[model samples]
Target chain A: AQKVTQAQTEISVVEKEDVTLDCVYETRDTTYYLFWYKQPPSGELVFLIRRNSFDEQNEISGRYSWNFQKSTSSFNFTITASQVVDSAVYFCALSQWGAQKLVFGQGTRLTINP
Target chain B: EAGVTQFPSHSVIEKGQTVTLRCDPISGHDNLYWYRRVMGKEIKFLLHFVKESKQDESGMPNNRFLAERTGGTYSTLKVQPAELEDSGVYFCASSQVGVSSYEQYFGPGTRLTVT
Candidate 1:
């Protein structure tokens, strides 16, 4: 069974604070994909990042960064200098290579205070 | 390009009632998928469609749920005699078939409330 776990149910932080959202996954497949999606109050799920199993290199895009560690089975996301606009429900998902289905984690709701 | 879209942004129905939800995928996207997130639970896969054919239906909870993609352009998911437990946000996503990076584009989900 493939599963993504996001232990944090919710988190609150002041604007400009850096916050990290943790994600741990369990999968037997050696090659799989990990993803992060953001769901705003509007209810649209926006894709944030997708990382492949073979590539454990960390990624940084503007204020967003992702740390993929295969040894720990973790793919954590970090938002630096967060803004109020960053408030949303974030989901971590896992899928095996060539599988169209995604197994999602219970989302973590992050609230940024202005 | 327009993203995937789902109809009946929100629906409220009585238990045992029938409800139909529709999804229009982005143009040229051949792969469509359905997922649902029940309150307090992780989002789970419902089914998948490749054009007009069902690629995978293993995730469908029960026979009460039926999905159809007639012309391969739009799809419909119908729930007959819906149970209270069936209430959730139903999301539709689409991706191009054979794309190496199979990142699906999602729609604004339909919230179904069964009372």
Candidate 2:
């Protein structure tokens, strides 16, 4: 059974604050993929990042960074200096190598007040 | 290139009413997928299609839901008799073959309301 757990249901933070969203996954396959997506109030899912199992290197993009620690089965996302535009629901998902379907977590609703 | 597109941005129907949702995948992409998020819960996989061929549909809840991608261009999901539990956002996504990246492009989901 492949599952992704996002423990935080919601988080509220003031603008310019840093926030981290935790994601833990369970999968039997040795090779798999992890992804993060952001759904803004506008209702479109924006692709943020994707990490493969073999790549353990942490990724940083602009004000956003991801810490992938396969030892703990965790891939956490952090937003530095958050802004009101960063308010959205973030989702963590897992996928098998050949499988086309994505197993998504319950998602975390984030609100950044200006 | 146009992204994936779903018809009927919002729909309100009775519990026993039938509703059909359409999805047009990105051009030149062979992989199309259907997923749904019900009652603010986790988004779940419903099915996958590759060039009009049903690849995997293990996530489909029941027979009340029917999906088809004729000629492999546009797809449709029809609920013969929708249940109250079917109320949620239906999302459509597409990805290119051999992209090993496992990245999927999504559309602005369709919100279905069953009363």
Candidate 3:
């Protein structure tokens, strides 16, 4: 069975503070994909990032960065200078290669106070 | 380009009642997907459709649920005699034929409340 775990059920921080949401996954397949999605209060899920198991290079886009460490089976997301707009429920998901469906973790609700 | 779209932004029904949710995917996209997020739980895949054909329905909860994507344009999910435990947010997503699953564009979900 494939599983994705988001350890933080909720996190709150003042505006401009940095916050990291941790995700850990377990899968038997050697080739799989990990994803992060943000669902704002408006009720739409916005795709954040996608990282395959083969790629361990950390990625940075603007104030958002992701760390993927195969050694620990972890994919962590960090938001630098988080703003009120960043408040939302974030989800970590996993899927094996050629699999049609995603297995998601219990989402983490984030609150950013201005 | 238009993104995926789902109808009935919110729905409330009593137990044993029936409800149907609709979704319209992006133009020309051949892959459509259905997912659900129960309260306080994770979002999970309900099914997948390639055009009008059912590609996968392994995650479907039970027989009371039926999905149809006629003409390969839009899709509908019907729940009959919905139980209280069936209430949750139903999401629809779509991606191009050659695109990877990572590119599935999601629609604003339909929130279902069973009383």
TM-scores for all candidates: the values are: 0.98, 0.97, 0.97
Comparison by lDDT, 1 against 3, better one: 1
Model 3 chain B: lowest-lDDT 10 consecutive positions: B96-105
Root-mean-square deviation of candidate 3? 1.0
What is candidate 2's lDDT per residue for B18-72, written digit by digit as tens?
Answer: 9999999899889999999998689999999998999999999999999999999
Candidate 2 residue pairs in clash (backbone atoms < 3 Å): none
Q: Score the docking of each candidate (DockQ).
A: 0.80, 0.80, 0.77
lDDT, residue B64, model 1? 99
TM-score of chain B of each: 0.97, 0.97, 0.97
**True C-alpha contacts between chains kept, each model in order:** 0.82, 0.87, 0.74
For residues A1-114, what per-residue lDDT tens digits would candidate 1 score against the true structure?
A: 998999999999999999999999999999999999999998978988888899999999999999999999999999999999999999999999989799999999999999
- What is the model-wide C-alpha lDDT for candidate 2? 0.94
Q: lDDT tens string, model 2, A9-98?
A: 999999999999999999999998999999998777788999989999999999999999999999999999999999999999999987
Between candidates 2 and 3, the DockQ winner: 2
**By how many angstroms RMSD does model 2 differ from the true structure?**
1.0
- Model 3 Cα lDDT, one tens digit per residue, B56-93: 99999999999999999999999998999999999999
Give the root-mean-square deviation of each candidate in angstroms: 0.8, 1.0, 1.0
